[model samples]
Target: MPTYEMGQWLLVMCHRTQQPSPDYLVAAFPTDEIREAYLSIASERAEQEVRHILRAFVGHSRSLGSFDRLQVLSIEALRKEQGREATKNGWSPRFTEYEIRALNHLSGTSSTPTWEGLTWALDLLPHAPQKAIDVIHAYMYAHAQVLPDLRISGLTDAAELIRTRYILQGSASIETLLELILNLDSRDFEYLVAHLYEVLGYDTEVTPAQKDYGKDVIARKINETVFIECKNWQGHVGVKVISDLAGRVSMEQATRGIVIGTSGFTEGPATATEIASRWPSRISLLDGIELIKLMNQHLGSEWHRRVERIIQSERSRQDRRPK
Candidate 1:
């Protein structure tokens, strides 16, 4: 299914599950990590579906609470009935023939899934019958909070279950990445910032730390040049810092300026940057959260290259320092 449809399907499931008399129950599901990972790359239609449905169906407070439980159940149950006889006589025939066929087809008899294949099973939920959906709901409820135990529960193939687990675990790696970014030293973090600009299609130059003229990175996109001041401080970035960057932009005749702070900017700095918007050389502020969002979006294939560049830059700086 297209990502929008999948996202819409998940939204519908969340809304349906919210009903007091829902046809399916959601016991346990992948935490916020997996959902955020999917949402980061999911289509705008899917994102709007989530926002509109959650606000109209439940409320803003309950938006993030409804994870992709429906998709998870559908995939898990589909895998269990794969390659099995669809006869009405066996196992009390709880599922209809249509459900059986659908599930079996979705759960291909494969050993392991490629990276792209891991999320493929979730595409089965959009058109599944209520009976099949309910069966999955029950099974997942039974296996709730003990997912690793699914390998022994025999609900799904052991290899398939393990693969699913591994995929879900991999989706959660963004948290690790966030932590790593937060803990990076000043110089390494500056290189990362420069690399991020480069990935965003800017021609970037990292200025020397001591005499940077209040700019850490000079990035040019065609005719527009943006002077960037980076701060890896633990405390709030102040208005004076942004003012200095704005002055630098004016001095250098740059088109604009950016203050990228890992700790985030204070209200005063935010207001100052906003006020600078009226001037010829506008200045913008990017807090840690916003920076991370950009990194998550743009660091797809270039992620390893950016990391290597940061490491290499740090090593070069260390090597060049007087011994």
Candidate 2:
């Protein structure tokens, strides 16, 4: 997870399960120890693997120039409807500089949300992301030596200074893709995985509809080849599946193998990972939650555009077909 700071707030990027896009949540901690404590607890409990820092900004106070003055000015125009006062638009005189910083963090450097789109921004204040809030409460309860005197009435913004770049443009499309993935047929899921890896510069092959040799997709890059087993079953994947994937890796002489399961792994499979690790072939397992993270990591700028094009083309093709 990457982090950003503006004045007194710390913004962290988080990707929800099955969602390709990231959401930015801001926090304010009084000391570095407290901040790190929060991160340690969050990382330990996070469902997805959180690594790699993409972009960061630190130690900078947000200024009025950081926001779009024009966008702000336009909000007043929308406050009135047909000559009489109607419902107020999102624009409010109560917006503080810290809130603006939060907005900027979420809006991404390339674009900022219009004032009308900030309906949820202010409400998010004084409460970090749901998970962060939970972790902070737990930390305070422990009363660790780092900040034994620290007390948090509520989440404030973090200001010691750190900020990271966040992309906002494709969030909607990515959400659509996540929904599509969750509802897609098992076959469609395999194809989607193949497509994602292909776009990421891999030479990918989807196995035949018949016997798939324990692997649904095979992706190769340079000398390394990855054999992937896709399991869309709703039940937990047991040791049998992992055992089969381990065998397939040896047969294919691949560099690695990954098991992607929608339901997740039972203790049988999870506990078996250590045994597989002893083999020459490395095996990685990802449940539904982790699968989404992998997709988010692999899919880059071209992803949103590609997803839109594919969806539109599919719709057109269906419309043109005979009834």
Candidate 3:
């Protein structure tokens, strides 16, 4: 006999004719095999046979009425929905399956996983190290407040090392840097903006992916607060985007608002001038060209071979450790 996990399969009935009525749960099974076995014979008898069997199982206790469709959701889909709900509630950071596996491998003995341990574990994985790094960066960006103390310190040190490496060896020119920035997905682009603010001496927080209230990042320095909206669009951002940011700025009482558009703003300089005149000091726009310039100014253009030195040093340090 094979054992099955509880709540692994959900039998949902869709009643399309019932206006404003949500999908009703007809039954919950421990496995898809069990659910399929229950419906297969009935389905083979007749199209309406499955419905009759489900109705008999329902025992007239519940009023699902007539359902036109039936859907069986697997455990993976249910877990994804639960994860989304958790993220929306800001209760936990969502991690992909690979990330969770890596973290679990690192936390074999202890309840908490440290950044250094995670890095070591990731080095042993077949996947590229950058994927795990992005996962860590995203987790740190969104859940900075609730991270363990040791993990926080370790992640801070690792982030500093990576940031220094990027500043030194990431790109040689503004054009190359802009190309790399453009290749990042929307979520990573938001993280890039948040990282830039942190580098610029402002404490930053990235809002949860869902329901961010039109702001992607919030930055604060001393008495000033800034709300940033990132648009990783291939086309130019329009006035409506700027208008929405302006509203959020006022609502959040932010000191200023900045929109970073990867493909620049519509109508070129005219749009920038119009926004400046309308919002004055309240809003600022940074197109791709200006964003590159700002990065060059702050991140510098000089290239040093420090990244190689750091790698060599790390290798030597690791080699000295007991095997």
Candidate closest to the true structure, highest TM-score: 1
List, residue by residue over 180-275, the lDDT tens digit for candidate 1.
667887777877887778767887777777888898887888899988888877787877887888777888788989888777766633564455
Model 2 lDDT tens row, 139-244: 4454232221211222222111111001112233444545656676676677777766765678777776688888988888999899888888767777777788
| TM-score, candidate number 1 | 0.43
Off by over 4 Å in 3: 1-171, 268-273, 302-323
At residue 194, what lDDT does model 3 achieve? Answer: 69
Q: Give lDDT per model, in order.
A: 0.52, 0.48, 0.53
C-alpha positional error of residue 107 in candidate 3 after TM-score superposition, expressed in Å: 65
TM-score of each: 0.43, 0.42, 0.40
Tens-place lDDT digits, model 3, residues 124-238? 1112223334555775675464344444544544333233323322335556666666776676677656655765788777776897888898889998999999998878888
Better of 1 and 2 by lDDT: 1
Candidate 1, residue 239: Cα displacement in angstroms equals 0.8
List where candidate 1 sits over 4 angstroms from the true fold: 1-178, 268-281, 301-310, 313-323
Clashing pairs in 1: none
| Best-first order by TM-score | 1, 2, 3
Q: State residue 53's C-alpha deviation in candidate 3, in Å.
A: 86
**Candidate 1, residue 126: CA error in Å?**
25
Candidate 3 TM-score, true structure as reference: 0.40
Backbone N/Cα/C clashes per model: 0, 21, 0
Please provide the root mean square deviation of candidate 3 (C-alpha atoms, Å).
26.2
